[model samples]
Target: MIVAACVKLVDLRPGVDRLTGAVTPSTTLGCSAADRAAVELALQLADSWSAESVVVCCGPDRADPVLREFAAAGVDRLVRIDATGAPDSADVAGLLATTLAGLGADVVVCGDHSLDRGSGSVPAFVAGALGAAQALGLVEVGTEGPGTLRATRRLDGGRRERLVVDAPSVVSVEGSVAELRRASLAATLRAGDVPVEVVAAPGLVVPPTVTTRPWVPPTRVQPPPQGTAALERVVELTGAMVERTPPRTVELPPDRAAALIVEQLRAWGYLEAVPSEPATDG
Candidate 1:
């Protein structure tokens, strides 16, 4: 049996493409904590069932660093689905379904939600595409010997339901379910040389999305305040008009007056000093 874990390389710090105004993944690539847990779950399943473990990723060549990282953590195979630009959810699901079908994967493990979009709908879409059984939002997973699996899923109001799932199944798990194991130095060194298999994603038409600014109410025009006196007009226009305080005359000596003026200026933020460095004699 072969178990495949689907992972994504999200941008730790995303940058906007100036020309297209689309969000671009940065060089600082890393999988989400939930994806890390999915990989770990796949590895654990492989260990228990003696099944070959595979980690599958979908991204461009620049996303190879994350693939290498997963390899070091010890999956039997690393496959990169060649794709560029941000594919829509349905397109991504189609790509994954096609790849998994080609691999003859008996089990597919994935994180419940992606860091980019928290829709958590890809696993369901993949299951639909492949005509496979799905157990999503699982908090616990275990084999039921041979072709069956045991899963406990989270429900609304902090409730969990246990399920018995048949094989050729896709399951999405939460990050808190498992932690990935550490890789030894030798394994890390060897992972760098383990050639990653590249597969081209099947061409799928991503549905176009329409984006528009929020609707705002138009500005309301009102007639000028009907009042004869300026103060009455001001009162009508503002609803509440504050009278300015009259300036007071003060009697003080020149030095005291100067000091008081300087203090007032400082309080009003008009006496800020520039940072300086000691001059060096050259």
Candidate 2:
């Protein structure tokens, strides 16, 4: 069995300059937290199945370090798709799908979303391009049979659902469940010597899809007061304004409070309504 782990190199300490709204570079690059989880999961699965693990990435030359780190960590192969500038998510997905297909990967693992963009769309796009079953936000993965992949997916409201997918499937791992392992000194030294196979992107035109929108400050309007209103304004300025009443609080029984919480949840569409039983004539 062969497994491919798709990952992205992201800013290690990502943040925005509050005053400028511009991304503040931490001057470091590494695999994203989500991708690290995906890679860890892939490594674990490969070890369990005695399969080959491949680390794949699509980015510029700056991403070489990340790929090398993964190679040192334990991947059998390291492939890098060198891109010039930041490409669209669709283009990146296309490149990854193409590369994975050429590699003949039985299973593809990736992070549910990229830390930089947080769009959470690339994995699905790759699955669609490959015509493979997709399991998103998976916290656990294993094999049920020779050609079947079983996964536990994290859902909303802290719920989980187990799913079984056939071979040639794409699994997007959740970051919360993936903990990366440190590479040994020997492995690190070996990784430094491993040559990363570089591939050029296909003849797909990547148009500029992202643009910065100008920020506009809000404006407030105040109508001119005259006659009675003007007199009231003058009185207010003279410290004779009426005092406002404080809000009142109410306490309810434990059961009632729980019911109210449930009602609020339902009203806000956070809870689904239970279906009613079918009516029958007796």
Candidate 3:
């Protein structure tokens, strides 16, 4: 089986200054130790299924840097899509589907969520585009036959579900399921000369509903301290649980705040009062 791993290269430490919300570019934006561990586990899983070739794909902007990193991490070919596009979920999904269509790939795998866009749409969308079955949050991938694949998916609340599907399937792997592997010095040298195929964006059309913006919010000063301990105690007691606290105190308007408080209370089963009956229209 030929397995392809889709990897997203993103700035590791994103966000303007926590204080000023300024934008800065740094090399630390690549994959982390945990991500490397996950990739390693994924490679091992693919090997277990007798995958003859494993290709890692990334966007043009991230190609060189990611290729170097993956090369050092023991990955042979880093498939770099040289087209300059928005890298939107749907657009990238289409690009990947087109690339995988002729590769005779039996199974495709991608990270459950990318750091840049945690939309969780790419894998499934790619599967749909390729007319393949897809499994999300997969922890383990196994094989059933020459053209069949089995995936073990991680579910919420600490459970797992196993699904077996025919060839040409997509599997999105959870970061916690497998550790991405780190490349050795020898592997890096060998991977440097590995042939890379540059593919165009295929003029795909992505939906216009999504917008990319740098998240910048003006810094706000903390509220003035009141000397009265009793007042602080009252406010604390009246406040909801700490875990449910929302950041950006001013972001929630009055109506939204009321709705959220009531919703949280209902979710926690703390609301004991019953509403009055509505009057019939005359």
Candidate 4:
């Protein structure tokens, strides 16, 4: 089995000056959190299945160091697509799809969302371009059988769902699901010498289907209160300063505690009805 993991280098340090609201580049550059999660998942799956793993990235020449970090993390191959200027998310997906097709990858992994844009559209777009089955927000991945893979997805309110998809599928992983392993000194040194195959961006044979709207900040209006309203405001402020109550704790058996938690969650409208089990005739 062959897995291709896509990653993006980002500036994680403080980028915005709080007082001036001016943006600046970070002192250090590293893989985006979501991308690191995807890479870690790919590496884990590759190790468990003894499969070949490749790390793919696209950016300016400055991103070479970030790609090397993936090599140090134990990917069999590192590929860098040399792309300059800011491309739309669709174009980036197109480039990645084309590269993965050339690599003949059986599985493609990517972050659920980018740190910079947070658009959360590239993975789906790449799957569409490759005509591959897609599983988004995956927390865990494992091989089910030959040419088949299982993905465990995280849902809101701590729910999880499992899905199985055929080979040549695309999966986008959530950052909080996994932690990346640290690279050893020897691996880091070896990575410095590894060749990074750079390629030109693929031609935009197909135009992007999505268009972004102009951003407009919301406007807020504040009307001053007058007369007795000021006196009422002071009274209301004083009333709001009530003492807080600490939460009560309860002890119960594990099973009973779980049941009670589930019950309360359902009562609070945080959980839907339990799915009915399939009926079987004896």
lDDT of 4 by residue, 1-282 (tens): 888898876666746655456566655667667889889888987887788999888777778878888889898888888775457778888899999999888888898877777777888988999999999988877778655778898899999999998978999988976778899999999999888888788564444335344455766684543337877766555656457555667799999999998987897777997878999999
- Provide the lowest-lDDT 10-residue window in model 3: 29-38
Local accuracy of candidate 3 as per-residue lDDT tens digits, 1-282: 676777666776655565554556565546433244345644665567656445556455545756566656655455666654345677778777878776666677777777765666888998999888888877776667655767787788999898997767777776766665656778767766666667666665544434345576668686664547977756666654336645445468889989887877876777855576999899
Which residue runs of candidate 1 sit more than 4 Å off their true CA positions?
A: 16-25, 205-282
Model 1 residue 142 distance off true place after TM-score fit, in angstroms? 1.8
Model 1 earns a TM-score of: 0.70
Q: Would you estimate the TM-scores of all the predictions?
A: 0.70, 0.71, 0.66, 0.69
Separately for all candidates shown, the number of backbone clashes (residues 3 or more apart, or on different chains) is: 0, 0, 13, 0
- Compute the lDDT for candidate 1: 0.85
The predicted structure with the larger lDDT, 2 or 3, is 2
Q: What is the C-alpha RMSD of each candidate to the true structure, in Å?
A: 20.1, 14.4, 9.7, 16.1
Model 3 bad stretches (over 4 Å):
14-22, 32-38, 145-147, 156-159, 202-282
Q: Highest lDDT among the candidates is held by which one?
A: 1
> Candidate 4 regions off by >4 Å?
14-22, 156-158, 202-282
* lDDT by residue (tens digit), candidate 1, 95-147: 88889999989999999988887678989999999899999999988888855
